[model samples]
Target: MENYNKLKSLVASIEADADKFFNNGNSAAGTRVRKGLQDIKTLAQEIRNEVTSKKNDEKK
Candidate 1:
């Protein structure tokens, strides 16, 4: 639960940072922000998978 919450917060922060970079018109910074956003997205997916697996295990 804690891990999931942390990942969610991280995703939110990355999204906000990306928006800032995008609005500032820094192409290089925007690229970095995109990369960070992708990483956060992957982390979020992993967290979701872990949560789903845990729930499945509990059901079994």
Candidate 2:
């Protein structure tokens, strides 16, 4: 549960940062934001896998 909350907060922060960069209309900033967003997506996927594995273990 804590991991889930942490992942949610991290995603939200990345989204907010991306929005700020997007609003500024800077190409370099936009690129950085895109990279950051991608990183966040990867992290989220890993977290999801961890949670799913834990759930399956509990069921077993």
Candidate 3:
């Protein structure tokens, strides 16, 4: 649940930066958005692996 909240927060931040970059051509904001997106990808994979492990544990 904590991780879920963190993921949501990162997505919100990325959305803000993306809007700034798209609407005003801000390179710095674009960089931040890209970084946030990469974080999301990493955290998402961690969560996925955790869930998969839990499922496997239940099966075993």
Candidate 4:
């Protein structure tokens, strides 16, 4: 659940950059947004693995 919160926060943190990149044509913000998205992908994968592990544990 901690990672879930982190995922939420991560997305929230990137919102400004996303908005800037899409609405204001900021190249630097676009770079930051791209980096943030990659971080999001990694964090999402971690959360998926954590959930899968917990689910399998419950089957025991």
Top of the candidates by TM-score: 4
- Backbone clash total for model 3 is 0
lDDT of each: 0.77, 0.75, 0.90, 0.96
Model 4: residues with Cα > 4 Å off, grouped in runs = none
- When summed lDDT is taken over every stretch of 10 residues in candidate 2, the lowest stretch is 11-20
Model 4 has a clash total of: 0
Clashes (N, CA, C under 3 Å) per candidate:
0, 0, 0, 0
How close to the true structure is residue 48 of candidate 1, measured as C-alpha lDDT?
83
Stretches of candidate 2 exceeding 4 Å from the true structure? 1-20
lDDT of 4: 0.96
Clashing pairs in 3: none
Candidate with better TM-score, 3 vs 4: 4
User: What residue runs in model 1 are displaced by over 4 Å at the alpha carbon?
Assistant: 5-9, 12-20
Residue 43's lDDT within candidate 3 is 93
lDDT of 3 at 24: 95
Q: Residue by residue across 1-60, what tens digits does model 2's lDDT show?
A: 776687677767666557767787667767776877777788788888998998999999
Better of 2 and 4 by TM-score: 4
lDDT of 3 by residue, 1-60 (tens): 677788898898788889999999999999998899999999998888888998999998
